[model samples]
Target chain A: MPSPLRDLREQIIRAASVAGEGHIASAFSILDILWVLYHGILRHDPGNPSDPARDRFVLSKGHASLGIYGILAQRGFFPMDELKTFASSSGRLGGHPDSRKVPGVEASTGSLGHGMPMAAGMALGLKIRESASRVVCIVGDGECNEGAVWEAALLAAHHKLGNFTCVVDFNHSGDRALMLGDLAGKFRSFGWEVTEIDGHDHAQIEAVLKPHGGDVPRAVIANTIKGRGCTDMENNPAWHHKAPKADELEAVLAQLT
Target chain B: MRRQFVTTMERQLDEDPRTVILLGDIGVFAFRNAFKKHPKRIINIGILEQATVSVAAGLAKEGFIPLFHSIAPFVVERAFEQIKVDFGYQALGGHFVTVGGSYDYAALGCSHHCPGDVGLMQAVPGMQIIVPGHPAEFDALMTQTFASGKPAYHRLSERSNREARCVTFGKAEVVQSGGGPVIVTVGPFLDRVIEAAGGSDATILYYTTLAPFDAETLRQHAGDGRILCVEPFYEGTLAASITSALRGKRIALSSMGVPRKFLTDYGHASYHDAACGLMATDIRARLDELSHV
Candidate 1:
């Protein structure tokens, strides 16, 4: 694992430990995808977060807010020290990303199936203004169960939002409740250019994150393990919402290294 | 009224570059000319009410003033959480202009009816609810409030009052003043309320804007502490505002509108209105009963 990615995992673990609450497994699933987007793909500035021409990224699956917050902190949108206040009343960072409070967050999304449509709208707005900016929204496989997710898929396709991309974190977290079978095929049928990739692979993530020149929107199915780094937590539903205690934190950090 | 909405939107589109119209496949024909003029601005977004609202929120986030149009139930009731969360929680400004207010689509069954839209929107903090009684009033209210940088719900109805009063946002017009009980009416109910309170000493307050509830006007005109709200939506939609407006004072409040229950009996809006006792005679009797009290 890359040193920075390893450090980010440690930061997420410690912050969730301090807060005593977070969807740690969910965060781990999308950490690398978020890291690649913020570091390489998204045209954003921590200094001027509200740049009119900046590409918008909406984490539609907001339970993984810890992942985005850690990346944003590392990216200098805010100081890394703020991570200690994660999910605390005094902190701007909550369990779910709030756009109003957070600098880099484009949409305040906690509810599943909202971010993609919002991203489509942003893409549509940019297209109307003849701007070069793009919008990327990430949704969980569980979020696909929401009718609004498919509704947004149909809308983005109908509008021919070529600038919009929806990344699905296919961590199989939703498989226990209702299996989202054939997600890529579903996006293809909905008129989106579908790309399936290993979410943890930074090279694979960076390759598909760019603007694909076409009228149809794009959907990236990012196949990821629930907890990619830690051995005990990997693909474990029990770790979905659990934060490590002091002893468990030592073991999780060891696994990350 | 939908025609007036189209006309107003056309004028808005021509005047303002930021104005975007998102239709939910309902009023596509009406916006044909507008679509021709501003092809990109006027989008006939498919019948996905939830996604459409979030899309409008997205547009708002991008600093464009988006106006989403659809039926009352689909836009306001069905996609209410989108309006509440996407716009209200985000503090993003957009407009939701809905036709088929209350039982306006009464014959289409309960699925199409949204008598609870105003009430539902009222629950969303900072949401501006406008129930225009006339086409001209719709134009005036939409013109004034659409770009106010706040989430607003504009409920348009097929029924219009005989006359159009000069309406302002958040300010209720005193149609007639009396020393008797205050009779509050909103949207098209103004004419019916007026007719009901005919030859009586009841003060009629017409509300084109429901939210930011014109409590000042209500407080000033609410003499003898007897208030009767005759709304076009669910009964007591404005109860909180009324009571909150005159909190300390002892006020006798009664309301008449579409019952909170579903109307399983399919019929025209007029038939539903009559069934729900929303006619002038019923309103007059209610007024008389309040007067006696």
Candidate 2:
């Protein structure tokens, strides 16, 4: 039997190939974390995507949208056939995810640094409304370069919103890899419960994301490789925005198998 | 104007449970009673403007109508991209209430002076911009804005001493009528325009809302084809909108507002208004010039 991770990678490759180009490597890096979230942690119903009591998931690092699209479809949020229309002129699946266009998407995020602030706001709102639901935001390590992310980080801690959780996909890619030294330390100083873990490990990812009943927002520093499953694409900066060509795609898929 | 905003927001909080007020650590004590009454809804997210606006966007997404408040520059200029993407692009509705229009805080220098706030918001598509002339107008527009369920920006100046007038949303109030020239006063600029007109024959069109602009009213009152626009923000912010409203009409138009340059001369709002030709006397002279043209 094919592993769900392998199946998700195939789905992403198929969609990205049709779209001509995508952040395949970026999507692959966050695949496991997203899988564990939708399958285990997140209290969301595919039938009722707009369930007020359900937990909210915002993919702040929206460049890795394929991972989310794959998971949502697999979990029956929408038809898997919709993935073929990814990045098409009239398709709902654009390069970045839009909440209004897609089901199971809590916030429309493509611009870096907006998701955490939005998630913080959602958490604050949930707290105000006395709802037990939580808000989880997935941000890229590169995306943390934005000052808005830090501003949101400070706000979440200041409010002591325990319902808010930020998962940083610390793949150490791009110029931000060199600039964002000691990422966990930065989040710790911002007053977050920092837990550095091997991102590809599903058990560890699920462990941190589950509620721990603290008076502070939690930051899970999921240390990951840029392209986790594929050997050729792993740690290759060129795969940040570039899709794998025919031969490379075959090679990557073979590795996944 | 800010007091009326707080009063209106307090009422909104009581009426609607979904209404949440988020502040950027500005006006901490101003909303003391509100904080005391509704502790859960009113949130002071420290001095983070970017997060403040983004959080409002997020709350709006989560079925909560969040009314965010801060100084004009911090709310509009500082976190403008958040407004552009989080609210505008995402199609989320949030009420952005900003104080200190133009040189309201002249003593604090250019940082507090947000002369370009309206222009900045105007640049983003789908943002309903409202500038109330009085407390009553503020109340009416605030009610209408929350009810509208659309993304909006309300620019509040420091002065609210003018008599409260019955103002409608998306409709201009014809204060004084004539045929010489149409003197359009935006928000708090009404008192100054009224003073400038001084029983003149020019038609006075006072508008509290700018985005869903009442073009039909402007056409009805602008019979002489001569119009003078007096605004409290950056010059020519509404020129494009006015031009679009009166398209294909042969008319003489002139605008009076704060110039694009920041005025280093520190004083009251009136001082900056005078220096930038945004005061009543300056408006009167411009109206005279427009009438002749």
Candidate 3:
């Protein structure tokens, strides 16, 4: 049997192929983090997705929605068969996740830099209510170009939201050259507890994601390759939004297996 | 009006534990007491308009009634996408409190002027747009909006009318009884429209809310079809709604508002109003011509 990560990758590829289009590479980069959180770290019940006590996960890098959809379906938030109908008008899912349409989607986010502030607000609300629930947000390295991200960062730190955690997918696959120097230092300056990890290393991902009750927020810079599983597509910018053809898909599936 | 806003917010904070006020570092002094009384609830999220709105959406999702406040330009225009996706797309319930309507801070230049906020917000589906006419109206609308448990935008202005009526959402208040062309006043422009009428038999209808426009009420009042709409924002912001409301009727309509042209001259808001023919005199002149036609 394949590892959980391999199985998720296979599901992601099958969905992308069926949809005929998706941000497969972008989804692949964040797969391990999503896997670890959904499988181990997040305090959630698949039977009760809207439980008040459950931890919240926001996919701030929403273009890579396939990654989230796979995890949600795999974790039993919905049926796995629904993945085949992704990006179809008949299907509930769209190119970007819509919270109203999809089960377990906390917020509708396709436009970059929106999810961080939302997660911060959720964390603040949870803190106000004195609930043990935590909020985990995943944003793309490319998506940090937005000014709102920093605004939320400042707010989270200023408010001392220890219940909030942000994970940046440092895949270096933005349309432009990745010029963000010392990402960890920048987060530290904003007063976040910054940590660096090998994104695909399940152990490292889990270690950083473990919730620590502290005054400052946490930021985990997960160093990853864009098309993580398949070597030919790894760190390849061209694969950002392009779906693989049948032959390529078969090869990718074989490699994952 | 600012005082009334603070008072009502304090009451809300005391009454409703779910009420939270998020500001973009704009109303630090104006809302001091409310902030002091409820430090955690009345949050000054620095100068981040985008985060301010997105955070409100999050708060709304968590069953908190958040009132995100800022200047009209920054609150309505800057974080518009978040307003659309985070609030409207998620169907989250919250209130967006915006001051500096149109050219309230005209001397401060274009950045402060927000004549396009109403029109921009109208583009977002399911947003209730309210432009209160006075302190009394502001007090009532703010209370109702919070209690309504829905997404709303309360566009406040520095200007106020002498006459105060019981204001409600999606309903027009008939300020004066008359028999000639119907003059529809929105926001604080009710005072000017009353002045423009100037003893004319023209009926006056004032509105605090622009969305869910009381078209049936408009039709009942403006049966003659001669209507002049005086709004505080961009010209004809309410035209489409009015036209839709009074459709199938032979209506002779003329709209008076801030022109679409960018005003380079920096002066009082009244100066811009005068330049754009939004004041009472210009409104009277337009009404006279509409009467002739």
User: Which CAPRI quality tier does the interface of model 3 achieve?
Assistant: high
Specify the poorest-scoring 10-residue window by lDDT in model 3 chain A: A172-181
Interface RMSD of each: 0.6, 1.0, 0.7
Worst 10 residues of 3 chain B by lDDT: B141-150
TM-score of every model?
Answer: 0.98, 0.96, 0.97
Off by over 4 Å in 2: A174-178, A245-252
Q: Which candidate gets the maximum DockQ versus the true structure? A: 1
lDDT of 1 by residue, B269-288 (tens): 99998999999999999999
Q: DockQ score of candidate 1?
A: 0.90
- In model 1, the runs with Cα more than 4 Å from the true position are none
What is the Å distance of residue A21 in model 2 from its true position? 2.2
Residue B113, candidate 3: alpha-carbon lDDT = 88
Q: Which has the higher TM-score value, candidate number 2 or candidate number 3? A: 3
Q: Tens-digit lDDT track for model 2 on B184-217?
A: 7788788888999986789998888898888999
lDDT of 1 by residue, A62-94 (tens): 999999999999999999989999999999999
* Model 3's interface RMSD: 0.7
Q: Note the DockQ of each predicted structure.
A: 0.90, 0.80, 0.84
Q: What's the residue-level lDDT of B246 in candidate 1?
A: 93
